[model samples]
Target: MRRYGPAVLLLLTGAAILRISLLSELYLRYVQAGLRPYLVVSGFLLVLLGVAAAVAGRREQEPHGAHGGHHAPRIAWLLALPALALLLFPPPALGSYSAGREAAQRAAQGVGAFPALPAGGPVALTLAEFSSRAIYDSGRSLTGRTVRLTGFVTRDDDGTWYVTRLLVSCCAADATTNKVEIRGADAPPADAWVTVTGTWHPKGSLGTDGAWPPVLDAASVRRVAQPANPYERR
Candidate 1:
């Protein structure tokens, strides 16, 4: 077993990757959907390499004293533990904890006219879009229009809570926070997924610090299962 440690580590890690990217949509928790094919390829190659290494190791003749003098380091075996964990129990998507750590850091965008909302009933929007329109749209596109947004709940030290989502350009490692302060509805438990329907509660001047984070006066807040792809594309 010790002699095959490298191959075991590679195989385990590759299987874990394939378990998430190829067998299920769980990969979406950590990366953009567009990168799925690359993950699949990477996992496949790693498995192939592991098999090759194992076969090669088995065929090579070791000198009689080789095993007596130098042993495979114990630390190498420990490296497989994470791969085993990932294979059996993958990590959950980024949630309120990640959101709570992020400060309100809105990108500067000039206040400009946003396209008109679709006519009629409540429109579903990602938290990123809702935040952008509420903060920078000169036309006040969200005013008087009911909108629905879905995200996990996060709270501030002051007891103010937000319906928050993370925005990722490539993967969770690069994720930035986007959230809307819920004015009327009670906050669900931290990291609880929910959909809130409401109208924009405009405050402060457009495109200013006072206008940041955005606010919603939620008329109805309904608990929902977390979406398959929790991160919004940036």
Candidate 2:
């Protein structure tokens, strides 16, 4: 058991990541929906490697010396660091702190027309889609259209505020913000979820390299609890 400590620890680590990713929040901080299969495969592989190592380690008997000191190869110990850290401090889903620390914006979406809103009342759009229209399409798609948008509040040092969401290309490491300047009311507290009903600000400008997220002339803002699925794909 002593010699197999590292191997057993690894098995636990892989199992934890696998279990949490499927049954809890672990998947939110890393990878898009498409990468779920890869994560599953990797977790299984890690578990297999760990089990194999444990079996092999158990069969080996290190020669004991007269000095009465136990010596065993500890190379596998390094693998536990990441697993331990994860167990102690699981990575959180992206939100205000992430938004605040990340670059204010990222590459603008490709300049092209957006698909027409679905037929109904005010169309609902994810923050990424709304931001693309606001930034790359010059708000043409949003002009004169009342829409519903939902995200958490984030504020600038200057007291300007935004309705913001994050898009994860692969994982939190590459996540980027989709933000819209909020006008016509005070922004709810940072990280507070809200649904905004609004039209695009007629005077909004499309900006360079996504530097300027477009403005929304909010008609109403309603605070809500965070949704179970907090992040969405681009």
Candidate 3:
């Protein structure tokens, strides 16, 4: 058991990775969809390495120690705990706590014209696009059009609440929050996913702090299941 500690740890870790990336879509919670292939390859390699190491260990003679064979450090087994935990219970996607911790950072794009929205009412848009157009678009494309947005609910200390989503460039570690303050509808439980349908409520002039968060006069808030890939890409 002592001589096989490293190989066991490697096998467990690799199995955990494969469980998340190859067996299920759970990997989407932490990484971009495009990286799935890479994760699969890495996990396969790790499993292969673990098998090779175990075979090599078995062939090699173990030096005799006071007990019998050389003993591995007790701490070596601790490394397996995380892999086991991940295998059995993977972490949930970043949610309200993550969104609330982020500071409001408006996009760097200057106030400018946005392409005309497709002719329609209740256009479906990502929170990032909605925030960008609401805060920086001089055209005010969202002014009269009803739009639909989906995100998890997050509340402020003052009873104010938002429909928030995290934007990620590569992985969960780089996630940033993009949220819109809800005006009319009562907020669902914190971290509950919802689809908000409403018209934009204009605030201060575009591109100012006052315009931040971009209010939405929600007409209807419907509870929805969290998406498989919750994070919006940059």
Candidate 4:
């Protein structure tokens, strides 16, 4: 039992992170939806490890001997830190602070041609999808189509305004941003979520290795609540 004390702490620590990730949607801040299965499996494995260690320790008991000497107390105490931090203060989702530091990462197109847009006046698309077409497809597919996009606002010191969203390759640490330069309206306050209706501005051009985000000739802008899933996974 005593030999497995640290294992128990490890189990709780892993489980606590998983619990917060699932129940509180804290996982959204750190990883893609695809990783949920791996996280679940890992949490269960930690619990099983602790249970096995506890059972084995019980069977190996020396009636008069201490299961674990005092030296291990510090290790067990240290193992509890992450678990305690998770319980006390859940980590905040990536916000303006993170978004502000990111660079322009929009592309002209993705791997292949975009699927046909709805046969109508305008097609609503994600900031990522719109930017991809703007940068990669040579303005062929989106030459005259109107697009509606929803994302948070970001304004530069030079007065440039952008409708922006984050795209995470794997985790927050690996997050890239998708931004559409709003051509007309004065940008709202930073991080204010909004939906914009716009046309692609061809002047943005086929993106070079490090070109800035394409521009959108915005027709209208509407305020919206921030979405539950803020990052686009690719």
Candidate 5:
């Protein structure tokens, strides 16, 4: 246990970071409301416990026959599996996998308005940034101009693919799903991260039954890999 103790502690620390960063959004969406607080508290405890275990293990190594064996702690390495899982299979982005989920309950309210752009320059914004700004300003400022955006793939009704970005407040637990319509030659694979340069055009008068209005008419689509920092905004 002593030999692997530091490795176990590192794994726990990495898991804690992932839990706070990427996976929080999934937990917020799928987990029951009542259990959220407990999950958070437990995550905090895990971090503390990992730190304590590491420290204790180091102290124990100083004393001979602490574990009544000649070998160092072997069991400590077993703790690394969960952290490895998190690194390998991160929670899915808030896309079609989560479309059927309740939007109002899951989406963040009032993300605040985007800053006004200077006259005559291409507008660059993430799906979340555009959505928050559009909500506040009614898309008045975004009309009739080329825009640059990036995100993974999501599809809308009528078989149109969107370049979507997830706005996460915490892990996958509290993620806001937003997407922009991608229009151009060559459809990219679902969930492939891409940078799109396009024109932002209104799809005309919010679709029936209050659907999201307007989509970007993509001028260019360049496929890219999942970024090191996957979330769109902080």
Candidate 6:
């Protein structure tokens, strides 16, 4: 335990940093709708565990000289579980679950701004990427071409399903949900991962003031599952 203390502490610290980073302002706005409470709880737990690990490291008994005692290497292996879990079953992406909640919030405030996409190429973007670009271009840049996207299903509403990709600045707590509307695909189970191939059509009438009115007319949709690391980097 003593020999592995530093590594454990480092892991905990790294996790904490990740969580805090995801909870930043831009990301937090969307994450708050569905995950704020859970994140708060998780944050508290992480803090407590971090403190416990620090205290334990300080209280541990010192090892004797090499001739007297050799530290056991087995304790270092204990960290494998968490490392494996993160590698294998990373938490699901923010999908349909956050759609309605976020949409409602955005509606109340009016749709936010978006940027224009550059000319001459199919934009390969995540929901977050498109959203950020939309802020600057308002869908003007993506008017007539296909945009490829991938994300998890968050939830479904009346006749409309919302797909989302999580953009995390640090960790889940700071993660933000970027949403896209699927107009005519078979609805997959909520939280299922998927890739969407479609064209962006400006929703001329449905857009909020200063926001681009556009929806993805999905040509094909395929379901998958969350990846090892679920967050999109800034």
Please count the clashing residue pairs in each candidate, in the order shown. 0, 0, 0, 4, 18, 25
lDDT of 2: 0.76
The lowest-lDDT stretch of 10 consecutive residues in candidate 1 is 64-73
Clashing pairs in 1: none
TM-score per prediction, in order, is 0.95, 0.81, 0.96, 0.76, 0.58, 0.51
Expressed as tens digits, the lDDT of each residue in 77-132 for candidate 6 is: 55656644543444434555544454321222333445555565556786756654
lDDT against the true structure, each candidate: 0.90, 0.76, 0.92, 0.75, 0.60, 0.58
Score candidate 5 by TM-score against the native.
Answer: 0.58
How well is each residue in 76-146 modelled by candidate 3, as lDDT tens digits? 78889999999999999999999889999767899999999888878999998999999999888898999
Runs of candidate 3 with Cα error greater than 4 angstroms are 66-72
Per-residue lDDT for 222 in model 5? 86
Clashing pairs in 4: 108-132, 108-135, 108-136, 109-136
Rank order by TM-score, top first? 3, 1, 2, 4, 5, 6
Task: Tell how far residue 76 is off in model 5, in angstroms.
Answer: 12
Candidate 6: 10-residue stretch with minimal lDDT:
103-112
Alpha carbon deviation, residue 71, candidate 5 (Å): 22
Q: After superposition, which runs of candidate 6 have C-alpha atoms over 4 Å from their true positions?
A: 1-122, 135-139, 204-214
Top-scoring candidate (TM-score): 3
lDDT: which is higher, 2 or 6?
A: 2
> Least accurate stretch of 10 residues (summed lDDT) in model 5?
204-213
User: How far out, in Å, is residue 91 in model 4?
Assistant: 2.1
